[model samples]
Target: MSDLATCLNGDLLCTEDATRLEEEEDDDEDDRFVFLMSRSAASDSEEYIRFLFSRERSFGDFGHAGGGDSLMRARSAAVRWILQARIRLRFSLQCAYVSVTYLDRFLLRRTIDSNQPWIMDLLSLACLSLAAKMEEIKVPPLPQFPAKNNYHGKSVLRMELLVLNTLEWRMSQATPFVFLGFFAYKLAGELASKELLRRAVDFIFAAIEGTNLVDFRPSAVAAAAIFAASGSPPTEKSMNQGMPIIESPELDQILSCYEIMIQAGASPGVGVKRKRLHLSNGSDL
Candidate 1:
């Protein structure tokens, strides 16, 4: 309770708060310099990175936390809806990420999901179309999704305007991939162990798969998952082992819930097969 109270009181700074303000300023300078250098390089890769970083900075300026985990919240269902729709429709991962951003931004303005799974595909395509217009030099034609579903072109165009109006014409977008990568790197510093870093990466990716699950809180789930996988304890660490060991039952519960949510959000299209080549093999189904 003391730790929680301290965290609530703002006296307990997360890793970032402990850093000197000067150092934080230096880091910002470094990010700016990197963007500038990349722009001078003038390659497609640089352009894409520039676009992402621009969007990230805009999110930060607008009080949106700039982390992949921030994009995931226990109370928010829209991100998961977009994610699930992308999976079901077999949309590219990059496109899915773009759609998730679009969906999140839209939710900032309007109520979303309302526990309805059926309308998700419609919302997902609309979000992706909006993202395509913003991110693509030439927007890709909306592909005919499936035999059973034919989204009206007029409907899509209408929804695009609705989304734009909902977002108040603020079109900057940021995906979680960059922030996730940075968070992993920072955790490596905190743990100072290669094995811990590997485990953290594994945990982040696993929790990311659960972005579709409503109960999964991105930042808390991410921190807890990484803490569990790294065998690290908060506010304490073994001198023998570099990484902190979070060996608490409460932490266990959080990690278990994360896994449960991921399983629940599992797409029906993919199945884990348990088959054996020999006669002694287990049931395939």
Candidate 2:
């Protein structure tokens, strides 16, 4: 093994005192996170939509997988930090996704210091902090992160700055959440229930645990999540009904992503669980 990979094969998976963060919020927080996007989408021309997908394509060319298993575990560990924060803080899943988007983009461009596993913990916390500032209705203070002896304020600030600079200060990430509503409506109509959207969100959070989803564009991942949530393959007519609903050229890609999510998210004697996610289509559910 390379020095980088060898340094990572230790017990840095998680800290023991994970659930100590005490945060409380009301049911009303969900209202603030409704999908404010236009379902008609008349405002977005085809060119603009294509531009969004193209940008995702450009952003997803992760060319830094030289470290094999240890590196993959490191990445997964960092994302789990975000998940732990989300569960403890009861923040919007959008916040979690934004954190992950920044983490993925940052890791794509910057190398983690192999000797400093705690740096992954700090980076994960910093990414979550940045995303909460962006998406949470009430951002929590960094003190809520259950910091160890080493996580000082200045260190976190430095790490946050490093993440911003690494991503060139561009934070308008096009995550799969951006396309969940549009793709679900386009492909499934009313069949895409409140229950279905909930499952899709679970699939997304579960599927994004590691690099299994690295190659997919956000839209493709969104479509695949919809399929995985439906708990069955899309019908031939449903899949072929229109312009961008998993067109023939991209059907295989969506299918491949679907299998990945099922494998990545499956549990024994149980299906995917629902998270606190809801997608509104400017109409009644």
Candidate 3:
């Protein structure tokens, strides 16, 4: 099985396991959960972080000479539209994330004429369709996709082929969602209810809408989302309360990324001030 599948199905506790684990002794379960968090944290080394950064860099057109602002606006608009459509269709958050990744990467490499705005919609359709296929178990047929956008099935297919080629068939690129389950588990431990994780995932989706957040690594974003969702102040007591403290290197990295999100005006207001305090103290947590 793919790493994502393994993480989602086994390490992160599928539905059955979650229900079963709830019945286990609290202390024993907390110990086991701590062990899993340690293992996950240990695996996320500097090299691993660099690898994710490099992979993200490989996608998305960060630098385009002239008309860059306009391009970003168009891209942002398309992303918003795609996200709304995904919600309407009841697609998974993963599908929206992957589709945006594909769309940005495609736009980075392939320039679209600003006058031909309809092509952007077509591209969004193609990317979203491909993402749905990748992440959804019961993907709607291409013909059945919403027609309000006026995308023809044949054109979408052609764009999909082009995107597949451009990405070198790498549809399973690492995304923030990939790290969410692990981080959420680390933050809440056995107490990490599905609702908490869902809120964190929701924050992630919200963060993705910010074009300024494009440069941050997915792992960092995942960590920040968890931090924001936990409602735990970044202070020493808050950070260490109810769970194992997030140690240095990792803690610093997540704080830096979270600050960036805050500066971009993208973070939820729940823990923003407390995070600033934690940053000021440089406390280990």
Ranking by lDDT: 2, 3, 1
Q: Between the candidate structures 1 and 2, which one is better when assessed by lDDT?
A: 2
Q: Mind giving the per-residue lDDT tens digits that candidate 1 earns over 1-285?
A: 332122223222123222111101122222332233223322324345445545544553232332234333422444544444443443444454556556655544444333433244455567776765665455545543321135456555666777777667776544333333333333444333333333433343344444442222233344443454445443323311322212333344445544553444423212111121222355111
Question: Which candidate ranks first by TM-score, i.e. highest?
Answer: 2
Off by over 4 Å in 3: 1-67, 212-214, 232-257, 260-285
Least well predicted 10-residue stretch by lDDT in candidate 2: 266-275
Model 3, span 1-285: residue lDDT tens: 432122222221112311110111122222232234334543455455556657755755444323476667877778877766665566655677888888877766566766556667767778899999998888887655553354445556777887888777878777775565555665666666444544555566555665434355566677776776676534445445522334444565567656644444433321111111122357311
Q: Residue 241 in model 2: shift from native, Å?
A: 2.6
State model 3's lDDT. 0.57
| Per-prediction TM-score | 0.43, 0.74, 0.62
lDDT of 2 by residue, 200-228 (tens): 76677777786444466677777887888
Identify the leading candidate in terms of lDDT: 2
Pick the winner on TM-score between candidates 1 and 3.
Answer: 3
Q: Could you tell which candidate, 2 or 3, scores higher by lDDT?
A: 2
The lowest-lDDT stretch of 10 consecutive residues in candidate 1 is: 17-26
